[model samples]
Target: MNSRKKMRGGPKKFKKLELYSRISFLYLNKAFKNPLILKVAERKHKLVFKFLEKEQADVIAKYKNLKEKKHDEVGVRYIWTLWWQGEDLAPEVVKLCLNQLKENSNGAKVVLITKDNYKDYIELPPYILEKREKGYITFQQLSDIIRFTLLEKYGGLWLDSTIYTSKPIPKEYFDYPFFSQHTKWADTCFVQHNLWHGFCIGSKKGGKLVSFAKEMFFDYWENHDVIVDYLMIDYILMIAYNHFNDIKEEIDSLPYSSERLYELVTILNNEYDEKYFNSLMEECIFSKLDWHKEYKLSIKGKETYYSHIVNLQ
Candidate 1:
C-alpha cells in the first residue's frame, strides 16, 4: 500500500466559499431543472464576458498578431510534470506514474518541475508570486500557471503528475500545434464551449492557445487577489476557445483521443487480469490515477489492478 500523504493545496476561506457555492448551484441545477436557475447562470456568464471585455483589447490583439510555427519546427521535445515536494517525496502512485512517463517518453525529455527548481525553468510575474506567497493562490493554481507558461516558451506536453502511461505517447499528438484530450465526458458550466482536458495539454512553442491562456492567467491574478473559482484555468481555456478563432480552429482540427484516460480508476479494485488489462491499454495509452485515495496492494491474496499498475515495469 502507498503510505505517503496527498496534499490538496486548496484555496483559502473566501475562495473555498466561492467555489463551494458554485458547486452547490451546479448540483441544484441538475437536481431540479429550473429555468430561472439556468437564466441566472447565463447572466453570470455574461457578466464574466463583460468583465473580460475590458481587458480584451490588448490580449486579443496580441493573440491575433502572434506568429504561428509548423509542428516539426517546435514538436513535443519535452514532457513536463510537477510534484512540488520532488519525486522522492511524492506518493508511491505518483512515483510510479513518473516512471511510466519516462519509460514511454518516446525519446522526449521528461522534466519533473519541483518547487525548489521551478524558477530555473520559467519566471512568473511579481503579482502571481506575491499571491502564492500570501496563500491567495494554491499550489494547484500555481501549477496551472507554470503549465501554460512552460508550454508557451517551450513546446511540449503537460501531463498532470497522476497520469500513468501504458505505451509511448502517440506520434499524432506531436503533429498538431496545440492538442488536448477533447473528451465529451468533461463536465463544466461551459460544457458546450469547452471540451478540452487541462490535465493533458500539448502545445507548440508560442502556440496561440497557450499564449492566450498565459495572458488570461497573468491578467486575472493581477486584477484579483482572491480566486473566483477552483477551475479558473479551465474557465479561461473555454473563454479563449470562444473568443479566439485560431485557437478554436486548432482545437477542432485534432482527432478524438484519450477516450478511456480515466477508465482504470473505476476498476482499480478489480482482480488483475492480463487479458482485461490489455483491452484497457487498447482504449488509451494513458490512465489517470488518484494518489489521494487509499488503494490496497492486494485483495483476498490476489493483486488488484491498482497494485499491478503501480508496480508495472
Candidate 2:
C-alpha cells in the first residue's frame, strides 16, 4: 500500500507547471527590459532602415509598451530573425523594440540574425549590425535556426520567433530534462534534419545527446527507412526512451492523457488516414482517439502520404 501511494504521488508531483513558471518569469522579465530590435544591415556595411510598415509599427509599439508594464520581472536577451523578404516592417519593429528596451531599468540586448547577400533593402541604425550570416531560408526555417542558435550562444532557457513571445516560460515546457525526457515515450516522432529541427527543450549537454540521436536515427532510416518512414525529433526521442531505462521510467511516471490528441483532431480537418493516425498514437503515446489528418505528427500519414504518391492535386 505504501509503495502504491508513493508511485501515485510521484508522477503528479513532477511540477511541470512550476518549472514553466520560473522559466516564464525569467523570459517575461527579459522582455520587459529588453524588447528585440529588428534591423537590416547591408553587404557593403551600408545600413538601410524602414522595414515595418507604418501600420504594423504602431501596433508593435503599443504591444511593446504594454508588455513592458505587464512583464517587469528580470532582465533577458531578446533576438529575432528576419528574412530579407519581410523588408517592409523590419525597421519599424526594430525601433519599437529598442524604445521599449530603453524604457526598462535592466536594459535589454536586441539583435538580428540575417542572411548575407540581401542586405541593401533596408537601412540599419548604428546599434544594429550585419552579424551571424547564414544561408537563405524561409521565415519558418529561419525561426527554427535562430531559436537553437540563441540557445547555444546565450545559454537562454527558451527562444521564440518575432511573431511570438513566451512571457513567462511555462513550466510544462521545461518539464523534461534532455536525455531522460526524450527517452520517456514509446513512439517515433519526426523532426527535420536541419540544425534547429529536433528536441525543442534541451541544455547544452542535451545538445550532444541530440547529435547522437540524430546520427542513430539517420543510420536506422538508411537501412530500414520504410519500416519507420520518416524520423521526427519526438519519435527519435521515443526510440531513445526505449533504449535508455532512465528516460523510459521518468516518462512512464508522468501524467498523460489520450484525450488531448482527440481534442486536437476534432479541431483539425480530415486529411489523415485512420491507419496512420493510429500509428501516430502508438508511436507518440497518445491515449485518445481524437486524431486529425491535417495536423503535423511524427510520421507522414493520410494527407502527407497521399500528397506524395498520388499527387492528389
Q: Which residue window of length 10 is worst by lDDT in model 1? A: 2-11
lDDT of 2 at 61: 35
lDDT of 2: 0.31
What is each predicted model's overall lDDT from 0 to 1?
Answer: 0.76, 0.31
Per-residue lDDT value at 221 in model 2: 25
- lDDT of model 2 at position 268: 31
Q: Write the per-residue lDDT of candidate 2 for residues 13-106, one digit (tens) a residue.
A: 3244234333333443234222221111111011001211121233223222221112222234333333343434454333332333233212
lDDT by residue for model 1 over 218-244, one digit each (tens)? 877776666655667766776777777
